[model samples]
Target: MDDSEADDPNRTSPRPAASGGWSRLSASRGFLLLWGAQSVSTLGASSASFVLTLEVFRDTGSAVALAVLTVMSSAGNIYLAPLAGAFADRIGHRRAAILANVVLATASAVMATVSLIGPGRLLGLVYPLVLVSAIAASMLTLTLTASIRRMRQDADLTRINGVTTLLQRAPVIVAPVVGAALYATVAPAYVYVVDGLTSLGCVAALLVVRWDAPPLAGPRRANPFPGARDGLAWILRHRGIREMQIGFAGLNLFNGLGVTATTAYVILLADRRWGSASGLAAYNVSAAVGLVAGAALAG
Candidate 1:
């Protein structure tokens, strides 16, 4: 391929000769940096999520409050994913990823500040901040997923995806344990500070990694709704994909309910019995382990 074509971000490179193991992925400096940044950020975010849920449940002693917070967080991803994806496509994936991380870092910092001033009075602020962070995080995830295709050959896509999936899930397995330890030893403000620092670290990694400019997709649309609508229509038109999505929606609904109920039950049980965050961490770790095992088996 010519230098121009090689430099086009929207163009997928021709597949190279078959390779074994992670040789192809490990050889790509860009993918390595991207992978490291994403893995670290996931770890930080997962740990912070554990801490936040525990704190919220402990503070309010109400399962409803915890459920509300969880709902608000998921709502951002569910409702705004299409819009976020469209926006990221317009801005360039690398730039969008950087912007999203910046927003996430800022939200974490603000939460930390609120915790320091007075956690009891400021607890209400956490809900809005969580919503904002969730939006940014969804955008970040969308951009990174798009970037992965551009970073490797078509033949290596499956392997690269498997590696990414495993690394992402691997963090969760240990994040709760680390989070519980942090919660037991430090103030909540410090936990937020750590989360913010990890986000900044991701931003720095994104900056250092070289990225090709995405090709222009003609004139930019003033409204993203058209693109989102078109995308949804395309999905609906595909019988297999449409059915799969319907199945997933039902599965996720029940899974969400089960997870929420189980989390509340375990936390409450631990509070009454063991009286520590360790119980929550134990539950999370076990669930995460199962998820990782499933991913490995699937891969």
Candidate 2:
């Protein structure tokens, strides 16, 4: 997804299970299903992103508005961040992951459905519906991510984390190419339908999973929201996480400007070299493949 790793850089950061008995790579049957669900949902996520960005420009023809998608997503992340971490830590990870997946699937479906109906953008419904759904999807996405992060035990941390990131991102690389081709071949509307179908696939994966997920213990239970400071309090205490926040703050600015600039850039460079939607999709896929390979090697 274009928004890949945007919410929490640590979302894919290593988080091997802090405690467990097995030296094996897996946690349980349920967790396995959960992981599979995440991978599939994420596939649709990137595919939708490619098609959606194309749709935005195709409809509005504004690099500026297309760039604003980052701002809209950031707003969602800000609103969700407070509760996201605490919810992951407090509620059973399995529960949080399942509920979040459901929420995201619903949101994805709404956005896709609105696009499919063809309101002509005269009513101005498509943009708002997609934005709202994006907000909800992001919130739930964080919880699901945390659950995946927490499932594996200590020894497998780096490898599992890398695999998860790869799983989350592999689609980002491949789906867009498929999406661009799909767009060239069919109406743009089908992309959203595919997205909706993938979300359901994620639900199916979730259903198949069978983790005996437990809740976080004592000090970790400190709820920091709804006036409870315990959860928010600890994150603030960590210099590293705080720095992560700062880095992302800067990234949003860079990314916002960069997306628009890329539009201009491709336009400028097209005389000598061209990066059409399909071309861009190919580039992204190659880069993500490189990153996935790197992560695998590093681990």
Candidate 3:
């Protein structure tokens, strides 16, 4: 297929044989690279997050401080998602993905520099950086998700999506443990360094993959706000989508609250009672295991 045809989600292309299954999907080098890159980047990002949480709690010793970080990150994701989508739609998905990862890498590098130079009272700087990283991460997520369909045939989308979901959740199980080990052994600045390297790795992977440029739009259509507004209008107009969005919004609200509270509580408890970072890591590991198990059962 031509590159444009490959990227066109609405193209009337013939489906590949279902019997090929995992083997067929595995044979696609680009897809394999994409998958592996995402897995590594996810793990790195999760580990960095775990380390950041520990650092923030250790420094400030305030649950409110942690809450602020969480709130800012979530706000960035929510507010920027539509704009991110519009951006990916304007640029090709591959370009957008590369751009996002580059931004993430830059952010990580800056955080590392900040940590090394003046680790004290970092909340002032860390908060804004986290917000920027969150927005870039959101953009990366949107681009990668959109690229999935272009990488494989329709028959494999369900399988690929399941794999992607697993990739998203599975890293949590190991990240805290890994982060704790790294945080204990090396300088915390190095943790951000690792995160930056992983992001660069993703950028390299994207660079090697061949992608067709997206079609250009007129000046009016090029504006992100119009597209975002139209998307919101469409979502509101659709009963099923609107209802689903509402349900997920409510679910995520409580989920975010519980997660932040539990994390803060566990960290504090571990520090005050157990007197070690290992306890916090253990709690995170157990929570992640439970989440994975619950998801498996539901599926």
Instruction: Identify the leading candidate in terms of TM-score.
Output: 1
* Decoy 2 TM-score against native: 0.68
**lDDT value, residue 214 of candidate 3:** 57
lDDT of 3 by residue, 1-299 (tens): 24655775433223335586653444366666776887888888888888888888877777778888898898778877878878777776767888999999999999898777644487788999999899888988887777677666787789989988877777778888888898889988998999999999998877666444353456536467765678889999999999999999999988888888888888767877764468778988898898888978998
The sequence of per-residue lDDT tens digits that candidate 1 reaches over residues 1-299 is: 24754565533332323553343444376677777878888888888889888877767777777777788899777687778877888877777888999999999899888777754466679888888888898998887777777667787789988888877778888899889999889998888888899899888877666455463478987786776688889999999999999999999988888888888999888977765588999999998888777866996
Scanning candidate 2 in windows of ten residues, the lowest lDDT window is: 5-14
lDDT of 2 by residue, 159-206 (tens): 767766767676677786787788678866676676767667766765
Residue 19 of model 2, lDDT score = 53
Q: List all candidate RMSDs to the true structure.
A: 4.8, 8.6, 5.1
**Model 2 RMSD in angstroms:** 8.6
* Weakest lDDT window of 10 consecutive positions for candidate 1: 8-17
TM-score, predicted candidate 1 vs. hidden true structure: 0.82
For model 3, what is the alpha-carbon lDDT of residue 107? Answer: 91
Clashes of each: 0, 5, 0
Off by over 4 Å in 3: 1-27, 118-120, 213-251, 272-276
TM-score of each: 0.82, 0.68, 0.81
TM-score between candidate 3 and the true structure: 0.81
